[model samples]
Target: MPYTAEISRVNPSCFLFLIDQSGSMSDLFPEVGCSKAQGLADAVNRLLQTLATRCAKGEEVRDYFDVGVIGYGQNIGPVLQGPLAGRDLVSISEIAFNPAKLETKIRKVPDGAGGLVEQNFQLPIWLDPVHNGGTPMCEALRRAKSLLEGWVVAHPTSYPPTVIHITDGESTDGDPSIDFQKKILAG
Candidate 1:
C-alpha cells in the first residue's frame, strides 16, 4: 500500500501543526479546567518532543522529520520560540537543538505490583500559549497550503507531509471552504 512508505533518516516525513491562538482560545476548557490555548500549546510541544525522541538513537538525534508549529490569531505565522523563533519549517535535528524552555515535571506511573511511582521528566517546549485577536484560520490555511505545496516539491519522493490542524471549530473569517475547494481542484 502507498501508506506503507519506509520512514528513516534518509527519507523522512514532515509534520506541520496548525494551532488556533484566537482570543476565544482563552475560554476555559471545562474538561481539563484549563484554557484551550494551554491544551493546544501542550499538545504541540509534546508532539515535537515525541518526534525528536522517535529519531533519537543512543546519544544522537537524527533528522527523521521536519516540523512546524503555525499559530493563527493576531498574526498568522510560525510560532516556534528560542533559536527557532521565526523559522517556518525546521528539521527534526534543529528542533532538538533549539528548545524554547525545558520544564521538569512530575509524572506518576504504575509499578509492576500495581503501585504508583513518581518520576521526574524534563519536558521541552517549542511553542508557548497565546490567546489573542480574532481567528484568521482562512489565512492560516492558505499559508499552510502554500508551504505544503513547496514541501511536496522538495520532498516529492519522501512520505507526504502531515498537517495536524487544531482549531476551535470556528471561523471568524469567511468560510474557507470556497478557496479551499478551488485550490484543491486546481491543484
Candidate 2:
C-alpha cells in the first residue's frame, strides 16, 4: 500500500515557498495592469490565507502545517514580514494571527441579481512586492534544503514537506538541478 501520512496538529506537514524577486519580476503584465512581482505576491498572500483558514477550528487556528517563504533577488532568505519577519518557518496559527498590515480593498461583485455592487473588504499583507538584482535560485534551494533537513528528522512520521518554486527568469547563480539532486534527492 502507498504511504499515507495524516496531517494534523500532532503530525503537521510543511510548505516551503521559493519566490523569485529578480529584476524581470518588475516587468508589467499589460493585461493584468500589474507587475509580475505584485501578482506573485498577491497569489502567495491568498494561498497563505487559504492555508490558515483550513487550519482554523472555531476560535482557534491549529498548527496543521508549518509555512515558509524565501525570496531570491538582491537578497535571499526568509521574506515573511511584520511579526513573522526573519522567521524561517512558522506554524499555520502564527500566520493566521500575524499579518504585516491590513488594507481595505474595494471590488465589484455580482449582487445576486444581474447588477454588480462594490464591496469593501480587508486584506492581510504579509509580503510586499519586491524586485531587484539577479535570480540566485541555486542558493535559495540550498537554503531550503538546510531548513527542511532538520524538519524531516524531527517529523519522521509526518507527511513530507511540499516545495513550491515560482520564478520569472533563469537562475543567475549556478545550475539548480545539480544542487537539487545533491541536497534534496540525495537524502
Question: How does each model score on lDDT?
Answer: 0.88, 0.94
Which candidate wins on lDDT?
2
lDDT of 2 by residue, 112-161 (tens): 99999999999888999999999999999889888998999999999999
lDDT score for candidate 2 against the true structure: 0.94
Worst lDDT 10-window in candidate 2: 178-187
Q: What clash count goes with each model? A: 0, 0
Worst 10 residues of 1 by lDDT: 1-10
lDDT of 2 at 121: 91
Stretches of candidate 2 exceeding 4 Å from the true structure: 182-187
**Candidate 1 residues 1-187, lDDT tens each?**
5676777877888898999999999999997898999988888888888888888898789998888889999999999999998888999989987898998878999877979999999889888899999988899999998998898898877888899989996778868898789878997
> Candidates' TM-scores?
0.91, 0.95
